[model samples]
Target chain A: MMTRTFLVALIGLSMGSFGWADNPNKPDDNTTPPSAETSVSPLPTITGGLVFNSTFTPGTQSYSPVVNPIVLVPLGNRFLFESEYNVNSDLTRDHGAWNPRQLNREIEYMQLDYMVNPHLTIVVGRVFTPFGIYIERYHPEWIRDLQVAPIIFGISHQQSMGAELRGAVHLNSKVDLTYTGFYAFNSTINYFTGDRGLGGRTSLFFPEKGVEAGFSYNRRLGDNRFNLYAFDGTWNMKSIPLDLRTEVFKTGMLGNGYWVEGAYRLNKHSHNSFLRKSQVVLRGEQYFTPSAADMAMTSMSGMMMGDNFLPDQNTTRGFAGWNYWVSDAVKLSFAFGRSFALGENQNIYSLGITYRFATGGSEK
Target chain B: MKSTLAIAFLTSLLMAVPAAAGNPSKTPHSHEIDGEAAYKANCTRCHIAIHTYSARSERTMISHMRVRANLTKDEADAIFQYMAGEQKPKAAPTHTAKGAAIP
Candidate 1:
């Protein structure tokens, strides 16, 4: 009986929304023709992509499809709500409660953003970790240069359930500065929540020069009061279609990591040619452990967590790849990578194709 | 009878907020949202199909889409800058795909 009542309410509610939606004065001006000036879409947006990944390590093998869908909703003019879920499913048979079955499955982020000012905005709820450029900016499969996430990418504070203040300032005509300061804690036993922590990033960018550099730090609270710091930068050449990006990470007194990467477009001067979309990339990374004991602890803990961001032990990794643009929205990528660690040698082969859809912005 | 059905329909439509993709004005007419990078990140998913509109016209038409696509002041600025010249104030091409792709 209660179910029937609820259904009636739902039906009534849906009918009301459609009624308002049909009002003639409600600005359903579908008659206006498309024009040249860029328009801001007030309508909510829905976008998602898929990933197929297989990895072979010394002790195990894995296969999975990474499908994540994200949404951004605006409430009124000052308040906005956004959320993303990583519905990853493991196809491997050796699936454990957390490993092949529950590996990295959860609502990645769900937050509300308030614009305090042009240079200051506040976010509340779960947010992307800002410890380094990679986690927050390039973690998306479609945006990422390589199919495989870097070993050190998810090292600390992937998400925080609290509050944050982030914005940018223009220093001058050529230089600009941006900052992100946030405090988060895991208030629930759900997936993707982090420990009690405070973290942020501050960067200086040269808009005209196409160059930027910055620093980030995090202080994880509670029993383990460890610190994580990183410095990152990017340089886009003015004369050619070549660019370089780098990031270095430091944790506690012992943990350290760094990666330097570069990409060059086969053609940049022309827009109509498909060859112009082809690009080549190369990268090198290194992570150092203070002692052998720490390396063991990292490896064991990583496996138990099902997110083994750290290698079996302290290691150095080199990567090379190719990115071909099937179109403006779809990209085909292949990567060949190698890892040098303490126990033995490791090889990684990654391939992925990402398709992105957009209605008003980010699409051309 | 027609009026009764209209009332019932409107009420139900209001309840189905999921279908409402509220169109927002870009400038002048409607109150502006900062439009931070966070908002742009979500916009990228479906912004694959690009549409061109004059800034003046866009500002005039605050789309009453029931779908909630929020924009911050920074994000709004970024979109404005993008539409103004299809360029951004600053860029990290090496790190991000630059030139014409939405931020």
Candidate 2:
């Protein structure tokens, strides 16, 4: 019932946006033809990518094929609706024959944005939680340089059903201040679940130097009352094709960790050469968890949980990977890494291919 | 101890680089803005490939990106002109009101 109500509300809002665009009070003259530089009518566009990955571990191997599709509908000059869905299947083998494929499908984010001005925008509906930069910017399969997530990826909630206010202000000619504040309501609905919380992030960006640093904070308000804090930074070299990023996060004594990654695109070679199409990436991460005895003494006792995404014990990992751009929209990648944990050491190998596509766009 | 020192060293290195490198000139004269250079500087931070859309779609997209990327009005206008192929090598002022009215 709640899901149905949310859907209806979403539809109503979208229709109202279109009506607002067509209102006669708008400033633009309707009879005048659009210039060659503009479009006569706003058109929706579809853009996303497909990824197929195979990973081999010490005694287990898994294959995953994922399709992530994004739809963008421009209601008018000020309103835009965008949504992304992730559909994937996982097939794994644990020493024996391959197991049955497990299918998973979920909506990553579905939101409507109203651009109020250059310094403020209002967003509503399900959106990526405004915590760290990784979840919002680099979690996409095609955009991420490494296939595997960092050790600290699980520290914060990935999505929230709420309203967000975000914008950027030019502090001066060289620095820009970007800020986001949001409130997410608690929901138990499948695929749309979120803990009741409020959070905000602020960053200072230097466009010419391609450098940025930010801090984030979140406080859960319900039964799981806790706070999460994070600091992230990125540097993109203007003289060379190099990028460096790092993130450190802690979640209320549950765990703490950090990851640093760097990628260098070999663009100095000839355009057609293989070396020119290749990018090299390196990453190192470490995770630390409190001992069982230490956790039992706190109010969070019995809340400790284990998952495939988060390490069960303290662990350190190092990875090296290469990506080859088959074309402007296709890429092939391979990576090898080692995980050092308390119980044992494991070697992990991954290979993947990604293709990004967009339709309803004018050819360049 | 070694890892701690390494991390500290890296953090300092990231912060210590001279901020003047590759600083674009702030000339007031109307001139041709290199759309490709502007696009590479701003858009390539997150996007791996350049996806072309209709001029109208590009306008909306750039408006959305201006807010998401915290781009300056001039920077957004420059990127829009480049992506939409509106004015190729034409002399234009930097503060033209072609895109969204951000006041």
For each candidate, what is chain B's TM-score? 0.35, 0.51
Tell me the spans in candidate 1 whose CA falls farther than 4 Å from its real position: A1-41, A55-61, A92-104, A269-274, A290-308, A359-364, B1-75, B81-100
Worst 10 residues of 1 chain B by lDDT: B60-69
Q: Which candidate tops TM-score?
A: 2
Query: What is the per-residue lDDT of model 2 for residues B1-103, given as tens digits with 9 covering 90 to 100?
Result: 4323322332232222111111223212113335555566667776654445556666656665665565543455666666667543222111111211110
True lDDT of residue A358, candidate 2: 62
TM-score of chain B of 2: 0.51
Candidates' DockQ values? 0.06, 0.14
- The alpha-carbon deviation from the true structure for residue A50 of candidate 2, after best TM-score superposition, in angstroms, is 0.5
In candidate 2, position A132 carries an lDDT of: 81
The DockQ-derived docking category for candidate 1 is incorrect
Determine which window of 10 residues in candidate 1 chain A has minimal summed lDDT.
Answer: A29-38
Q: After superposition, how far is residue B86 of candidate 1 from its true place, in Å?
A: 9.3
Candidate achieving the largest DockQ: 2
Restricting to chain A, the TM-score for each candidate equals 0.79, 0.86
